[model samples]
Target chain A: MTSGLFHVPLWIELVAAATGGIQGALFAAGIRDRRIDVLGVVAIGLTVALGGSLMRDVVLDQLPVVVSSEWYLLVAAAASLLGMALQSVLTRTEWLISLLDAAVMGIFGAIGASKAVAYGAGSLGAVLVGVVAAVGGGVLRDLMANRPISIIHVGTLNAAAAGIGASMLVLLLRIDVPVGIAGPISAVATALLRIAAVHLG
Target chain B: MTSGLFHVPLWIELVAAATGGIQGALFAAGIRDRRIDVLGVVAIGLTVALGGSLMRDVVLDQLPVVVSSEWYLLVAAAASLLGMALQSVLTRTEWLISLLDAAVMGIFGAIGASKAVAYGAGSLGAVLVGVVAAVGGGVLRDLMANRPISIIHVGTLNAAAAGIGASMLVLLLRIDVPVGIAGPISAVATALLRIAAVHLG
Candidate 1:
């Protein structure tokens, strides 16, 4: 019944999905040993783009937005195709991919936490949901590819960034901040933290 | 709203979860190259046991029964531990594990489809949900172990068995059959089909 509470502008969600889709496709294409065909790449990409939001909705006991919304699959599939087309160029620029990945994670984390809060989950639950939304896609992709889960394995501080951002939003909301203001700030904070972690390491 | 509609006796659900957990743990322990630790084995076991119900609840937009019920985790963990202890003996007898796996899948499929119909999903959706519930655990387990998904890869008619069982249940219910009779019959049909597939192969 808490439908539309977590709805950001369609463009914003599309941007997040596109970035995630592209990143996922690139990641899949990069696997030399794995015989991932075009369909597999697309499936992996869509899974990365939409998996977080799907998990978030499921956890909130709501109909998954990806399944309900008409535009979600179209955008994700198109983005995946674009990513596959540009795999050669995308693979060469690791830094750009990293930056986009961080941004996408931030966007997903903010939306997930906001939705959880709207659905009356506790602060801790909201934070956990946010992290799951941020990294759930990557985990699915890794699983499908038969690789170590990036979040659990030794890798970038993916979960940490999402957690920090989600916690900050929760703190802000507790202090009477509107979700409109809190959401974007949380996303930017997550993105910056992720970028900083990548650079520092 | 349909909270109590799919409520089987607690003991029946427990039996399914315990068997699934034990089978999952045995499967995990058999993977010599994975080196899954105690915690990992337990996690995988719980996933296999509870994952189906969780997915079913999520799809139906209801609170996940495994998370809501206190007994679920305790039973799953205890069964997993028992499985690990019996691994050496279990390994020598692969037939028993396969039989148990088939039964667990059937139980999950029957329950999942029943719940989906209770929540007003269409017949196709119900069947799909049942297949997902049946195979979802194995998929998760395979992912955690960094192995190819068992259902998608060549081996058994996993998804096919679940689909047939779920469809049979849906047909029975539509034809005015009692759920108590329909559920068990569908489950038994699934188990027999799976066993037959394995034996023939």
Candidate 2:
């Protein structure tokens, strides 16, 4: 669901949305004091799934791809409902959730930076936009849940990892690497860094 | 500033930005444990002054006026610095701050709703946009400070007042009232409601 200017595969966007939705639903369900209903959980999930892309497009001054694409909402809602239904089983698999979160962050970071680059922003600006897009959804989720912002909190590697990936993408593009190749490289590197931090730290 | 599709006087936009800047500076100064430097405080002030407009424009799929206009940043920075310099004096004048805050919220709400209406959004959609615009800055501030969201907190009249003002603006416009008249009436009503709630409650 990227802008028509870019040519990311539809499946990639759907996967990103689904993963974000599942992670967000799990997060909302974990909050005990909020007394959030089913609809609230789904809404939070949708926010997490699309908030980043929405922010990215907003910063780029383009129409929000999420609003125009019906697939995003439908997939996010289904994934969120699935997450809610299997909360007990899914809670036991923390590693999977972490992996999903890391992947979502990485994908969004790559997409955002790429968009900025395409728009002719300087490297630093592209990186900044990418990091914002990477962490925007989680920021919204934490704010809604009244929790400390995860990206700004002590010991969190989110923004750092996102920045590293975005910088790599910018560097690769500068060196004449094709975007299709550069984007995946950036995403994988970011996810690995986040995954390593979580398991090792 | 409203979108190019609509015309709001430049003075009104500047006043709103200045008031928001001052209020934000006062707020950031009140937070004792953050160890926020002068630059941090100014950044917070800018966020409060421009965040709502940025969000409003993003939702409307229009370029953010804050990003495009040099006047907004200049005025907001000057007002924020002025607020910081007058911290002690400003803190003592609680009623004045409250009045300014209410006015800022009202103006932003009216502007946001009018933009939505101008874009041909339905009445309920217009009201939603207005409420989001009115409370967005404060929400961002609270999130940054890691405080409970003020708009959603029990006993707060912010969203309720904004909704009433936005609804009123929509109704007035439907009756063929000029936007200039409708906007001010809505703003005044919202401000009065907020002021009354603070004083009487």
Candidate 3:
């Protein structure tokens, strides 16, 4: 019911959705053993793109932004198709995919935390919501694709990056910092941490 | 926000949650390859018991009842522990587990549809919400357990059963039938269909 709680620029949100969709589609398409059809690939991609926002809205007791906004689905679907088309090229460059994935997660985390704060959720709840929003889509995607959840598995520190970024944003907000300034800073920090974890491992 | 929308006896809801918790724990404990700890089993069981309700509340833009009500979590946790203790005995009886799962899905579907109707959702949305509520927990459980989602895979008619029951409940509610009668009838129909599907297969 509450609109505009996602105070970020529309273009930034679109970029995040596109990034998530592409990564999710690529992940789905790369699964050789499972027989996920074309529709399933698109569904998984949309889940990744829109799922975080949906979960965040639901947690804040608002209508899911993805369901209420037509553009969100359109952008996600388009990006999913593009990702499917480019799966061959995208799969070869693992580093690029990981980098993009981390950035997207950070964006989602910042947005989710900001919205939760706007809704008057406590600091701890906001951080948890942000982490859930960052990783919730991948959880849904992995479930649908019949693969291990990337966040929980002994891989990169996906959740840790989201948590740290969200906590930083919350702390900055408490200090009267503009969301515009805090959001990108948090996102970049998360991206750097995630990239470091992946490279170091 | 809407407290009494469930409209079911407290005992019935407790029974449904207990059944789901036991079945979920048994399922988790039976996974031969997965290294799920006792805590994981408890978590999965709680997800199965309370996930549907949490999802339903979120979709309806209401505060999740699970988080709001201490009783919900307490009952779910207690039932989960009971399931864990009985896992060895329960795993040996597959038919019993399937029966309980079907019944739990039915109860959740009925409760969800009824609540959606009470909350003023359209009939189609109510049915969809009901099915999601019935299966959402299992999807979460499967994702956490790193297993294939049972609803989407080509196996039992899990979502189908929930959808059918939810639709029936909505239709009955439209005819001015009380939720008490409509809910049980729909649940029984779902359970019967599920049981028949299992036996015939």
Candidate 1 per-residue lDDT, tens place, A1-201, comes to: 133355556777777788889888877777778577665676578768878877887878787666445567568878888888888754384766687778878999998888888888889998999998888888877777677887778455878989999999888887878888999999999999988878876
**lDDT (0 to 1) per candidate:** 0.79, 0.78, 0.78
For model 3, the superposed segments whose C-alpha errors exceed 4 Å read A1-22, A33-51, A54-103, A121-131, A139-201, B1-15, B18-47, B54-92, B120-129, B140-149, B152-201
Q: What would the TM-scores of all predictions be?
A: 0.62, 0.60, 0.62
Q: Quick one: RMSD of model 2?
A: 6.7
How displaced is residue A195 in candidate 2, in Å? 16
lDDT of 2 by residue, B1-201 (tens): 222367556677778788888888777776777565565566567668877877887787765656445577568778888767767665475566677779878999998899888886788999999988888888887777677787777337877898899999989988888899999999999988888778666
* Per-residue lDDT of model 3, residues A1-201, tens digit only: 122444556777788889889888877777778676665676677778977877887877786666445477678879989888888664484666677688778889988888888888888998998898888888777767777778888454878888999999899888878888888998898888888778776
The alpha-carbon lDDT assigned to residue B42 of candidate 3 equals 90
Model 2 lDDT at residue B44: 61
lDDT of 1: 0.79
> What's the true lDDT of residue A201 in model 2?
49
Q: Is the docking of candidate 1 incorrect, acceptable, medium or high quality?
A: incorrect
Native-to-model Cα distance after best TM-score fit, residue A155 in candidate 1, in Å: 4.8
All models, DockQ values?
Answer: 0.17, 0.14, 0.18
On residues B21-78, what C-alpha lDDT tens digit does candidate 1 reach at each position? 9888888877787578888877788878888877777777887878888998789889
lDDT of 2 by residue, A7-48 (tens): 556677788788888888877776787698888888888888
DockQ of 3: 0.18
